[model samples]
Target: MFNKKYTIVKNEEVIPGHRLMCLNAPEIASRAAPGQFLHLRCGDGQDPILRRPLSIHFADRGRVYILYRIAGRGTSRLALMARGDIVDVMGPLGRGFTLPAPGERVAVVGGGIGAAPLFFLLKKIGKIYGKKKDMVRVFLGASTLAMVPGAAQIRKMGFPLDIAADDGSGDFKGTVVDMFRKEAKNLALDRVYACGPPPMIRALAGAVGPDPAVEVSVEERMGCGVGACLSCACKVRAGEGEGFGYARVCTDGPVFDLRKLVL
Candidate 1:
């Protein structure tokens, strides 16, 4: 969890309104895990006072990748940065997804930009589980065909992948949760990891019922990346007791058990 200014090695648009920024930060990269994020200071200005939090898209060698959507002032500032520019970042923060034991049937779900981290997760699994990679399947969704995440890479890796697009532009023309529900009826998945819109997350929770096999990487805004501030609080089941308790997403998790989440 280092906080420092890192040099931007590359910044390219993967699609309109979305940019992929790479930083030369070996320290953070080496420690990065799937589902972890970085707090990036968008610019030198004081407007938008808080730094924007972006998920770690990919990390390799000495480079860390950030895939972000340019939706507002913070992200807009990030978009203006070019290769060789310096960016302030605090990273590898929060708990990441847990890996499955060998021979376990695994499924990963990602929606829209949330798929960023899942790509890194899948890449690692594909590498570590090579011959047994066949046990893993992936579901990805986006608003359009152009927005779908990691389809090409997933396909090339020979993993079974199902893509759903809201605009009916992919192999499946429906919500990703719906696609998973339809197909998951037959296969008994040992562990499922997901990250996406709240509605999608909630729907997935409902679809899976009481199964604790589902783990979700939540998307929330942060005040202090290290969890000192009380921002990014999430609701989760408080066990046999009466009510729900608040969990700090920045520290307790960004990833949580679906059965334990309050939705």
Candidate 2:
């Protein structure tokens, strides 16, 4: 994990209240994996003392992408940044999703801003496994089509997509988990991955049962991005008799098996 200042290559509002920022951080980009995140200092001073954590939306050879919602003070500061601005960031940290073998069928489920990190995963999947529509399927959920990040990009990439909206503004009129429950078997999904709200993750875990084939990337508030603060601890099922244990989301994981997580 490297702590460095990266120049913003592109920082533009993609949809209302959500912005996509690109950074010229070759070191962090090249080493970053799917489901990893960056801890960012939104502005020059420490008005916001704790750095905000944003997932790696997508990364290429020498550039990194961040898709974030302007939800609070830190994010509001982030949105104000322009193309030439430099931001302090630390990352590509935490455990990431395990890539599937080329022959295995893959599925990705995302909700609202949680859909951002999955973009890098899909891009990597396309590169490593080849972008055959049948090889991969995408399900995105949001309040409306406008709120779902990366939907157009996913469509442009040609992955078979199924989107759901709370207000019936997207393809489906129900929750994403409900849609997945109805379609997962038909798709013959070999492995499933997801990122979303806690309730959504809990529902997904309940539906999939305790299985290694399903993994998820969790979001938690962090004080120290490097695991020193113990601020991002989460529960996980320990073993057959051990009950549960706490794991640091920053260092131990942002990614874990849905079955193993105590939701």
Best by lDDT: 2
Write the residue-wise lDDT of candidate 2 on 1-263 in tens digits. 89999999999999899999999999998899999999999898879878998999999989999999999999999999998999999988888999988878788999888899999998888877764656898999988877888888888887889999989998899888887877786767789999998989988886764332998998889989898999999998987865999999998889998877886
How big is the RMSD of model 2? 1.4
TM-score of each: 0.97, 0.96
For model 1, the superposed segments whose C-alpha errors exceed 4 Å read none
Candidate 2 Cα misplacement greater than 4 A, ranges: 209-212
lDDT of 1 by residue, 1-263 (tens): 99999999999998878999999999999999988999999988889779998889899999999989898989998999999999999988889888777778888888888888898888788887887777898999898888975688888887888889988988799999888888777677888989998999988987864443888998777899787997899998896766799898988899898877888
